[model samples]
Target chain A: MSTVTKVSSRYERDKELFLRYAAIIESSDDAIVGKTLEGIITDWNPGAQRVFGYSPDEVIGKSVLILFPPERMEEEMDILGRVAKGERVENYETVRVRKDGKRIDMSVTVSPIRDSSGRIVGASKIARDITESKLLHASVLEAERHFRETLDHMLEGCQIIGFDFRYLYINDAAATHGRHSKKALLGRKMMEAYPGIEETEMFAFLRKCMENRIAQRLENRFDYGDGTFSWFNLSMEPVPEGTFILSVDITNEKKLQVELEKHRDHLQEIVNERTAQLQEANRELESFSYSVSHDLRAPLRHINGFVELLQKKLPSSIDKECLRYLHVISSASSEMGHLIDKLLDFSRVNRASINKSDVDVGSLVRQVIASLAEEAPGRSVDWQVEKLPDVYGDQAMLRQVFINLLSNALKYTGTRTTAKIKVRSISGKGEDIFVVEDNGVGFDMRYVSKLFGVFQRLHSNDEFEGTGIGLANVRRIIERHGGRTWAEGKVNEGASFYFSIPRFIEQRG
Target chain B: MITRLGRILLADDSRNDVELMLLALGHFNLANEVDVVRDGAEAVDYLYRGGKYAERGGQNPALMLLDLKMPKVNGIEVLRTVKNDPLLQTIPVVVLTSSREESDMVSSYELGANAFVVKPVDFHEFIESVKNLGFFWAIVNEPPPVSRNGGEQLEG
Candidate 1:
């Protein structure tokens, strides 16, 4: 009876130890599960309920295969069969589904739970949820792959150098720029690859960028020492390793710039030579003009003077026809003399250096009209002068232009009973165009091209008196002021002469 | 006889020019007192009382009519000599030439020429111009007294 009582107390102590172990298993953070050898769930703790989103009552008799993905169902069989055969599976990683259908990456450790007979009947598994840590690891690997892809496909030469002047990473373009293979260049010092690289201009820039942690740029010619050189535009920025370099080749563009500069210099030489020749010709023209003025007029003066003396001396003895012939001779000589003076004036207009200033053309027109008052009384001349802008030009020359144009307008309109002359000007882009329109005897359009030529006249001397040098001088003065001249006319109807003066002159040294 | 004017100097190269000038001035009988020289050298000699004028014995002729483009010396040189000299500078100088060049006019005026007259090719205008200047200078205008130093006198 005493032996029976002692065995009962020991049995009670064993029951208490079993209850404490069960309580520790219920509160474990990891899911602790129990299953039969047939892959059916036998026991599920509170940890299992929290991990799989299921209660113990719901999965106590359920098939453990439900927790496996359909594609990995065979994994359950293999793992459980190994456990039944008494093999311990520790930290086996696999994919499993929760009750809410969210998949998780898990680390599982399985052991055989045997009966007292030392035979495996069920398996005890402890699993850890590793989804967040696994995703973080995968994303880091993805970022590394993306960085390699971006640097490998770049067209500009991109390279990263380490602290010892070694190539840590080099792309395909960087490899081609150095004329070396990427496999042979990486992890190798640039000085070892290219023998004299340290002495190069680009090397100094790279060294400075590495030491000072500052960025630098260079368009330098790198000589490969085989009598061949290439121009490179290199940019270097300090990086955590050593230096990051980017380079683009511009050898052809530099060559084109050199060629263009040489061509422009050659063109300048030609322009200088041509200008010298033109100056020489102008000097000759000046001397010729001087000769015409001094030598040619003296004889004509003598001829006219003697003719006048002959007329005065032989007045009573000479017949009327003879006196008339004498008169014609005198007139012809003076006319020729007048022509010489006009020719000299035309020549001098081109040769004289222009004095440019702001000139009020309206006042100049009024002054010319006042001078023309001597030619005033014969005809009823109606002049309509518009308000004109002040133009930059030689006042005396521009005054001569108005003198010629206005006088021609007045003279050519001699036949009109009521002469109407209008001096109108309109502002244009970078210029002002002035029109001297008149209701006068206009010229034939067929002969209009000859209007501004020296000694070119449209009307006979009996019809209208002109030396024809007036329009030519006008054209010369306008052209010298950076302007142009043209005209429109119809025979016996009217004529409109147009001349333009620039509002602004482009400065030249 | 009330002689109206003093002797006037006429310097020209061409004999025809001298004849025409005489013809123009002879209308009013003003040619009687005009002393003609064939070139600028003789004109200079007559004014300086040297060379052919070594026997000259009168105040430098009443006026000098200088012609440009002479053979030996030019009107500009002759004018330079007369206007630069103290004794001859008092006489008036007129440049009567065939050249209407602006440069010639500028040089003449710059050299202290009293008047510049471009001889007209028209004989009637030539006669009118010569008559006007001749009448004004020889008769109407009076000459400075025989004072050697007649430039701008320093004011006290």
Candidate 2:
């Protein structure tokens, strides 16, 4: 009887311990409940109520289908059948409806309950609320999707390589640059995937980045496999255990640089050709000058020598009339010598090199007039020179042009009573056109064509003491200044000589 | 001392210039005398009393005026020959040529010629230059005593 009483007390203590464990499971956050194998809800704890939005009163004796979503009813029945067959389902997470009709994520553990006779009578299920964990996972997946979309749409190619140089991820831009699909690129080694780029600057830069464990950038060219080359500015950044690269096409910039270099080479070639031509012309001019100095002087000396001889050797018995005639011959020959010298100087102007600078044309013209007036002091000549425009040209050359024109006007008009000479400027066709007009023995219109030719004189030698080289020199000077010269005249009337200079010629020279 | 009316030798290539020079020299009869040679070779032969000039020469002329441009031998060679010969060096040689170039004048003077005269173009000027040349060289000037080989060998 005492043994029976002790066993009863031990049984009471064990029963009390089991009741305490049951209360702990009920009051804990985890949903602990017991159910019949026939798919009925036999018990519901507070955690179960919280997970399924149902109380024990509302859930007990009802089918467990009340806690499942409508779409998951079949799956719930299959699960219940499996539990009745003595199968325990552990950590079965599924969607359950709350009391507010909201779908919540729950993990369920269903185990078969057995009596001391070893027969399964019912099942106990532990349900835990896992909605927070599920929300975190969904948010992470959304973020990854957004990142992939952004990278794929970028203009620059983006690539991610593993520590072993295998492609972990590549955006659409990178796939297009490699001329392949993203699926083909994944899990492929960089060298095997893009064999051409393996030994290129791109590979070298990537290797450097890997070695240094820092970011690196390089500009290099790549063959596009279509007979064309593309330039790229590649930036490689070393990430933890991997490298990320961005590439921008710089082919257009490289093309522009090549074009500029070609242009420079072409310009240099032109300059070199022009310089050679100028040097050749200068050599010819020096020889020409040498010929002029040596050859032309010989004839003048002969003319002077013969004249002097004739004057000295004439017999005293010769007629006074004949002696006077001999004197005329000697004077004419001297005059001819002077003319030849002037002609030589005129031809030399062609060999002159132009040097452009600011020139005071007004003062130069006044000086010419003053000098001419002094030369012909006896003649009453009115010199009217207008305010001249400041010009940019070879000062000595421009002075020569004006001097020739003025002197010609003065010389031709010597016969006129109170000879009137005028120097003036007028605007014409974006040029400064200067005119030297004279009221004197004018040239015929027919003879105007021959005016600027070497030794082409319109008037007879008796009428003028000129070598006829003046106008020709004037023409050459104006032409060398990038200008033109012309004359208008009628016999016995006045003559006007005009010349113009282009504005750009000054700046260009 | 021998008088100043001794002969003057003028070597020229041009007929016109020789004619003119003779007319100028005609005025000076007593104090100065003029003799003309056609070319540089003839001038040298006449100075050495050889060739056509060997027969009737009495004495060497007082002075020799030589023209530059000529056929056969040119001016510098003549001047070089005259200056190199010790016998002819004492006889003053004047270069009277139409070449008025400074280089010609400098070279002639440097080659031991006494004077270089550029003939003038006008006839009156030529006469004046010739008159002055005769007056200065014949009347006013004095010549060094003739060398043994320089003066003419008077045959008589």
Candidate 3:
């Protein structure tokens, strides 16, 4: 039969079926059109008119090539060629141009059209606009790529492990931290890449996070199988695949802490050894002085005793010169004895440990002046004393210092008809300075350096008799108390002796 | 009542000190009242009348002048011996020494020394100290009467 006759016969036999198909094509949201095998449109629906922004009358005789862009025209030809051979092309996604000259995304399906006699004459096509869905999908893919790129470039190591403990992904930092390339670690089991890793504490923690989907953190000193170890502050979180881990290397900080502790311990040991050595030296020095006092004084006593006895046994007619020589011998020997005693006193003050206390230096000075007055009761002395302040020092030792200073003031001023001895103390920034100023026969400034030396004297024995150890003892006592001593004098003028006790001592205690 | 003669014992290691001590005691005319031992051991022996003094028997000395730093035995040990003994504890022991060490003085007093005197370096002061000691212990200060146990031990 002719094609037109066959088409009419099919429609004439199933008028109800023809009406149902016609209504579905007319109401469908997708574009439905009938085209000749040469890619021309013969029938068009309202959906097609809305999709392409064209009316059915304007496109019913037009070729389908008018709907495709130049780049998509080639693909349309391929689709039409397949449809002409009774083959169907389903979901052929492509780009197209609309009547408004705007580009749109589309998914199209084309099938062969058959008459009642089962012969193909043309094709039927369906197309849907998919521009909004395609835009959403492209944005999702871009966001995923951003996260991947960020993880790859981070300084802290980032890694993703699969449920089977295989390395699914490793960032550049993670590969560098592990001292391996990403190509070598990816898709490889952790235990296979790092032997004995399964036995490690880090592995146990990672397993717990992977299996329980729990988050955990730890500090791990990872040993690299090559006898090298590194420290990492590791934080793990449960991810969909298995676990995600971030690691920060802290080996330098750990090593610095260990080195600091070792250095402190070494310093403590050295300090302990030095303290022990000082204590031993002090003990030996104490014993040495004890024997010196006991043994050295014996012979002096005998010499004096024999000299006195020799004088007593001599006759009354003994020569005056001989008698004078005997007197010199006795006096010289006694002076030597007194010098030894003074030397020993100085050493004892120097060697003994001191106990610090608040001392009333003013009252102490008064007491010394009273005692010194007893020694030189006959002298007409004009004493000008000031109120002195208190200080932190060894009470007994400070008393010794005052005794020496006051006695010196009293002795040197013996030449003065009216001795003016002023005792006063002034508070300094870090020290409390006391002064024993005297209007006495002062010394030369050139010899001030020898003022505090042991057995160093400014005057002759005949001028002012002394053992020359008073200032020496004073210096020793003051130094032991962590103080300084200085003297200012001009010959025949007044002399000022100054000593300072540092105030920091009280604060430290 | 058995009257025990008052005898004094002087113990010193140095011959020079012993001679000087005797000379100073002579100033008070009490030298003959004293008996001497050269060292701490000799003094103990004489008190017990053991070795050199065994052939000679006498009463415990009324006073003992002890010096520290002696050979064979020390002054503290002798003082310990005498103070621990009931018979000899009654005799007054005075430590006269050249050592001014506080430890020696503390030890002497803690061990029951009747008096402590540091021997003066000056011969004149030495003689003055001896004059006072001689007059007080031997002449003025009354010695404790010999213990009844000591008298009985001697007589029995």
Q: Considering every candidate listed, which one attains the maximal lDDT?
A: 1
lDDT of 3 by residue, A1-509 (tens): 69999999888879988788999999999999899888889999889888899898888878888898988778877887888788999988888889999988999889999888988889999989988889999989989999999999899999999999999999999998899999999999999899999999999999999888899999999999889999999999998888999999899988998999999999999999999999889888877776666676677778788889999999999999999998888777778778778877888788778887777787887888888888988887776677777778788999999899988998999999988888888888888899999989999999999999999999998899998899999999989878999999999997999999888664544
Residue A481 shift from truth in candidate 2, angstroms:
4.6
What value does the lDDT take at residue B142 in candidate 1?
Answer: 82
- The residue-by-residue lDDT of candidate 2 on A84-153, one tens digit each, is 7889999998888877889888888989988899788888988888899888998899898898889988
Give the DockQ of candidate 1. 0.63
True C-alpha contacts between chains kept, each model in order: 0.81, 0.19, 0.53
lDDT to native, each model: 0.88, 0.79, 0.86
Candidate 3: share of reference interface contacts reproduced? 0.53
Residue A272, candidate 2: C-alpha displacement in angstroms: 2.4
**Residue range with the least summed lDDT across 10 consecutive positions in model 1 chain B:** B147-156
Better of 2 and 3 by lDDT: 3
Model 2 lDDT per residue over B37-147, tens place: 888898878877778987736566667778877778777778888888876787677788765445568789899998888665555677678777876776678777663
> What are the per-residue Cα lDDT tens digits for candidate 1 across A1-509?
99999999999999999999999998898899999988789989888888899998889899998898999999988998899789999999998899999999999999999999998999999988888889998999999889888888788889999879999999988888778899999999999999889988789889899999999999989787889888889999899999999988788888998899999999999999999999989888887888789789999999999998887788497788998898899999989999999999999898889999888999998899778857778788888999988899999999999999999999999999989888989898999998899999999999988999999999999999989999999999999999999999998898999999998755412
Better of 1 and 2 by lDDT: 1
lDDT of 3 at A354: 89
Q: Model 1: residues >4 Å from true position, as ranges?
A: A1-106, A111-123, A128-136, A273-288, A305-326, A351-361, A377-394, A415-450, A478-509, B1-119, B123-156
Against the true structure, candidate 2 reaches a TM-score of 0.52
